[model samples]
Target: MIASRTHGGGRITVDQRADGSGEALQAIIGDVGDLSVQAAVGDFDLATLLTQVPAPLTALNLDACRMRFHRQLAASLLELETTAVGVKAAAFAYRQAEKGISEAFGGLLDAIGYATGRIIAISLPVIIPVAITIGVQVLVVSKILDVTGLDDVITTHFGIDLGKTKEQAKEALVTAVFEHSDVAGAVIEHVLPGIVVGFVGLPPALLDTDADHAYWPHDSQSMTVWLLAGANQFGLLLPSDVEVWEAEGVTPPHEKPPRDLEDLYLREAACHRGTDSGQVRIEEIVGPDGTTRYIVYVPATTDWSAKSGDNTTDMTTNVQGMAGNDTVMREMVRQAIADAGIDPNDEVMLVGYSQGGITAGSLAADPAFLADVNVTALMTVGSPISDFAIGSDIDVLSIEHEQDLVPDLDGNENPAADNWSTITVDYDPDELRKAPALRDKSDAEIADLFDSAGAAHSSTAYAASIALLLRSGNGSLDRFTAKNSGFFTGDLKKTRDYQGRRKHT
Candidate 1:
């Protein structure tokens, strides 16, 4: 007989020698069985009996004994339904506990995943749109500014004072866009969003300005544009008022043409014929107090064949303003300064709009102009001076409005130093309504009619900024000054008093 104990607290007993032997052996078996029964009844303990065994146990024999005992115990347990029922109950409890644990862990993982997803969703919209908008603005400004070409122009012209140097201007622009909250807000709230909304409707009201009377007397130092021609086969050559009056079937007071066709032909001959006869007309206006002023208006003789369209020269001669005649105009300005009683060293204020803006910038670039006439400041509106090289001697303040693409001059050179400031004004629809002159027409109708033939490119809010630049000195005409007086006033819907108030207010 052999016996062994299992880890589950069960004991097994087996009979290995079961032969028909002496009656003594059978009697011994019977005696053992009686002892087992007594043990089961609590008269003896089986564990104490095993410790009391006198024989020595070998390793092999012990292992064989354990195997035989396990087999018998398994058979005995199978025979007892009560033991099987207990085993099944324990297994069921273990499986239920495992299921509970698995479900709890899965819920915790799901919670974590759900929380992570929420964070990503909340941040993505703000981050993606802002990053993309900034990238687009940078690319557009860089392409339009074209600092490389500006640097070349600066190096070619010895005069400084265009604004910040190209590198400095670029850094300043970048810093202004990023570090200045107002600028960023303007871009996000007004510029970029408006662009996304598209130009279908009237521009935002901020850019609109009241149109002043055509003959309004500005300050002595005011900026002005003196148109020299009427409508030609090329297009209307006068100011907006003249064009409007003409459209209404009103006859404008006729004036002598500023230049004769022969003069234009001669000027063109000088360019194409390689002659020095392409002389510009210089006019000196004497004020009532006997103060003499000079104006050098270039004749429309510059070859615009390159820009002429549908591939044919359009009725509008606007492209002529951009041609190589800029050099001739520059020389004419220098000569005009020399002809004036003032010394060439005298500081002068240069002001122009559209073609005149181009002329002013070109004149500022000449070393001769710089030496003979000290340009205290240069102001341009609707001028594409972005393509011209600016000189350090002149401080420039350029004001442009949305949808006015003419002033986005394609050939502006580089700014000299921090002396140049480019301001982009948003257009306002309501302000146009307030303008008594424009009240009869809707903004869309006005924009459509005026914007055609490229007139909108040269149009500005109310010419108040241009007027201020012309009248002021030291380059200190704040944008607020213009905002308060002109088209901006109506667009903002603010009281007239708000003009002088702090911008933050």
Candidate 2:
């Protein structure tokens, strides 16, 4: 069973619930939903080919082979829904079925049985609560290994190593226990509320389903978040004999206006300019009417949390960064924006990757920040901002790698407001290997995933992704272009800001 939906120009809910009561990965659910449509197309192609066959055929099981191929090809197609349209088409059909299902189901049981045919017509997707997905995984894990043993398995196999001392490894093992436990709790958080109301003879509707605090972790994010969280902790605790001085502040402005949002030259220009110097680069373009448009680019977190992980306060400072830790990053951006002497009246667009995406999102949502700067747009790649309640005025585009788990770390998505749009890209390493420059790096990156955890989180990967979207003529890309066309219209002046880490004794 597969289920997916989009509300009023609204974002797709990406409900993972399939046939029964299990919530599979969102991509799996999407692929399964399109099976029928794809089968029809395949059938058409086969029929067209069969017409060319000679009528006087020798004894052959070629027909059987064709049937087998049909089935096998379908399975392979389902493995990857090559285009966004194919994955999303069934969801659109499902929406239509839902509107019609209510009318058909209103009559008799016999009539309902007749409507069952229409149910098939409705599609193969089912809606299951989140509980089932978690329960199944938990049961499977229990059969294979106890929780404690699993901790050792994950710690030794999954956790990052910057050559930490023995004590640090021991500490990480202890921390892994909770990180692992969050897995089961993540399941409970989803199904428990709806279950409780039903058990108490209350309407399921009584459950507060739309709250900001739902635990909706995607299948891909579970371990990735753990790895990142662990990496931040390790980077902070693993003492280096030599004190490394890392600077954190934006550099003086470098004055070239960006020509196109999709241009790699511009993106590379923004990315290469800020290496190790800071978290964000401020670029300015002077519009015809004398209005300045500031494009503030924030790369993903350089470090997870604070370098010194002495206490729980460390969570607040982790460089992988957190929603609550927005202020720490925001202050740096805020100060940089100020130093750029950006006119309060100038339009601002924030762009970021991963943690920087979250930072970009957090600042855009803040009323105080918006009141001060005319923030007109936000573009984030592989960043999750479901917790943010941003307004409808800003034109927001969230680009996510379909296989990248970093964006789904929050377990929820940005509100489905009309102003907000999301585009999911697939940078599966297998596909990345086709590129010569990426070949060696892709091979060295372990498929064990634990070792190559940064697979889709790189700025380079996001750049490649944006390039794909542009070439594919993605609707979101068109919209993004039309919205920002005005900024590059007049004589352009580019400004750059620098930020970096400061070493402590």
Candidate 3:
């Protein structure tokens, strides 16, 4: 329920612990505006009719009555307009104030972080050698004790299991050092390049900046991968026609668009299951007004194998995605959209989870993809996609769980903008306990269960949290939905399910 301080001019706004109101305030304001418009139209019609009546009507003074009515109608209209404007102005001011305070605070924190990072980056050269020397000494001493049988004697008498203790201590120390400092980043940026090229057989040409730029600039992350894995045309690596095919299975028809974000997330969760379910689901919705909009459901990683061969949704694509490379999975999704008969000009909304979320963001930001596909709205769950530069025109709703590690992988916060809103749900064991399937389990058992399922990153947990936020009537959620209402209404035209593979030779 706690809101993160506004960052980058955006606020992660949601109070899950409280059901503040039954109706979203933004919806109420919209209703008020609609009613005002209707009233104004009715008044115009009545006034026109009234003007036709002579001063000496059949009974009363029509002129006086008309004048009185005119004054009353004008007053009413003004009041209604003022109310709507005031409410909107108040909300805007609140957000501006929040942004101002957050920016100031955030800037201070950034300054501190930069200073600390510089210190750590500089210290790494000195620290790494000392640590290695100490580690070798400890290993030698531990081996000597073990060979002399003093390790077991010490464990029996002094209750000191040196070997087990050192392992645990080493693990903790390494974790702490990496997590709290920029040591790993420093090593990757400055120290590891030469070591990797010499010891790991990496080609120097891959790291060359002047190397022909592919679809995306050969940035640091991409260059690192290229150095290690060797350079290849990303576009050639993924051939859509051969790799992607229609899933050969019957899926339940999409009769209607999802009623809310909760329902949308549930659909995303159900999209990918084992080999039978499709990794990509595209639903074409036809509205009553005959306008067509597409909703693309992209599920999380279905294949976890590190070695890529026939599966596009594998670990290799995940790495490519993180490196800002055009991944096979992204290509597969692009083909799925095109194969579904969706035109480049057709309005599209992409909903994704985990790795699927990253692909969605990347597609939204991709200039080549955007040239063909007009993605107007995007919803991502448990994804670290802050690096992607989504168009300002696109509406983005990112739902992240505080406990989920996936969203933090990007190492940057999602930028705040009018078109983008981030919802961060704090971990609550009570919510987990309320689930019928998990109700019988103890708190500890529930924690273990969530950990196994990727904690809050799991689609089920995201859907549940979204349900709560919906029930609570979040303004951010309402605003996002209101802006992209077309994507949530209309009869289902057809649903296309696509299955993708690597198609290695």
TM-score of each: 0.31, 0.51, 0.61
Candidate 3 residue-wise lDDT, 1-505, digit = tens: 4332223224434321111221244456567567756755765586666765664363256546656866776686567556656655665676778778855554444334444445556677898899999999988987899899999999999999987997788866654543433333333332333333333333433333433233221233543365425423433223222378888433575688988877788788777755532478888888878989999988677777555567666666677787777877788888998898888888999998888898899999999999999999999988878878888889898988766667766545688786888877775545644644456777687666564424556666676677767765777788878888887887887888888766555
Q: Candidate 2 at residue 71, lDDT? A: 84
Q: How well does candidate 1 score on lDDT at residue 244?
A: 7
Evaluate model 3: give its TM-score: 0.61
Q: List, residue by residue over 1-505, the lDDT tens digit for candidate 1.
A: 1111111101111111112122344455456556545644542356644654654465346546656765665555444434444445555666677668745543343333334444445667787899899999977766664655664465568655344575567755553443333333323222332232222222333122223212221110011111222122344331111010001111111122213212212222222122112223333333344443333333222233322222111212343334323333343445444544445543345555555566676667656556667665565655666545566545566655544545533412224245666655444434433444455777687666443333333332334223323333312234322321221122211110000000110
- How far out, in Å, is residue 253 in model 2? 7.0
What are the candidates' C-alpha RMSDs? 37.8, 19.4, 11.6
Candidate number of the best TM-score: 3
By TM-score, the candidates rank as 3, 2, 1
Model 2: per-residue Cα lDDT over 1-505, one tens digit each: 1111222234334431221122234456466657756765765586655764775253145556667877876776555544434445555666567646733432222232234434443443442434578889977876565445764575589783323545577756543432343333332233333333333344333333344322321122332333445665666433221111223334434434556655512353354333433345676777777766878876554433544432211223323344233444566677778777888888888887666677778888889888888888887777777667678888888876555555655544456567887776655545444333445664445254322444555666665556545554666566676787665566547555454343344
Residue 139 shift from truth in candidate 1, angstroms:
40
Off by over 4 Å in 2: 1-255, 264-277, 305-321, 433-451, 500-505
lDDT of 3 at 86: 61
